[model samples]
Target: MFSEQFNVRFYETDALAHVSNTVVAGWFESGREPIFKLFSPNLDLRNWPLILASYKIDFHLQIFYGKPVEVRTYVSRIGNSSFETYQEIWQQNQKVASGNTTLVRFDFSSNKAVPIEAEIKSQLQEHFYPQQESAK
Candidate 1:
């Protein structure tokens, strides 16, 4: 799993003095940056974008400003032209929210879904779960 740590800012807090629900989405997006960088060191996402197909978020606890947060992300499933990722946000060592996102592999030139390349899959696998020999 890939993870990132960040501090909740005052601006991210709502009238309740807790992090806003929308801010959790932004935190999830921030966690995706390193995962995408692993696929291509110099990837220009604007050129070859992975479009979001669907997503779900479950909020468990309230997050407050000045608290340190950690977001963990991992690929849970990979399909022919799409992949699903699971993300969790933690504050004070407790789960604050969890989310899942489905992204479609697209052909920028054609502007449509396309099969994921083998090389790309291999790269993602290496970063998310490196292969290990079975114990005998």
Candidate 2:
């Protein structure tokens, strides 16, 4: 699992003083940065290889500013051209939300989804969900 800590910034809060629902998506994406680097450490900014295909988020608790939020991300499923990322957020030791995103590997030049490379797949396999590891 890849995990990161984030602070609930004042700007991210709304009139009700809760972190905006939209903000959790950014936090989740932030948690994916390290994992993305594992796949493309030398990726060119002008031509990106991965793009988010879809995502779903379920908010279980509200988040407030001035405290740390913990996000944990993991590889859930891998296919020919796409993989699923499962992520969860926690604040004060309680689960704030959980979500998943589907990312597709693409050939920047072709501008279409492409199969995941063998080497990158191998690296992603190392971070598979624990249940997935047990299944194998």
Candidate 3:
């Protein structure tokens, strides 16, 4: 798993004085850039698009402004044309929220889903959960 630290900003807070749910989602997406780069350094978000097919976030605790948070992400499952990412947001060592996202590989030129590349799968396998049995 890879983790990144982010500070809650004043503007990200809602009228209730807590970080908005949308802001938390943005942080999760931002953390994914580096992980995607690990598989393809030249990954062009404009050319090679990965679309979010589904997402779920469970809010455990409220996050306020100025709190230090860590966003940790890992590849939990990889399928023929899609993958699942699991993420958690921790505040002061306590889990504030956890999320799961399903992303589908796409062929930009064809504007349709495509099977995941073998090379990309191999790279992602290196970061797979330790307890997961190796893919067949």
* Model 1, total clashes: 0
Of the two candidates 1 and 3, the one with more favorable TM-score, higher being better, is 3
Q: Estimate the TM-score for candidate 2.
A: 0.92
Count backbone clashes in candidate 3.
Answer: 0
TM-scores for all candidates: the values are 0.87, 0.92, 0.88
In model 3, the clashing pairs are none
The root-mean-square deviation over C-alpha atoms between each candidate and the true structure, in angstroms, is: 3.5, 1.4, 2.3
Instruction: Please rank every candidate by lDDT, starting with the best.
Output: 2, 3, 1
Tens digit of per-residue lDDT, candidate 1, span 41-115:
677866755778998999999999997999988777778888877889999989989998888887778988988
Tens-place lDDT digits, model 3, residues 1-136: 7789998889999999999999978999887876678545798666765888998999999998987899988888999989988888999889999999998887778889998889888877766655564544
Q: What is the C-alpha lDDT profile of model 2 across 42-120, one tens digit per residue?
A: 7567767889999999999899899999999989999999999899999999999999899999897887889998888
Number of clashing pairs, model 2? 0
Best by lDDT: 2
Instruction: Flag regions of model 3 displaced more than 4 Å.
Output: 130-136
Regarding lDDT, does 1 or 3 come out ahead?
Answer: 3
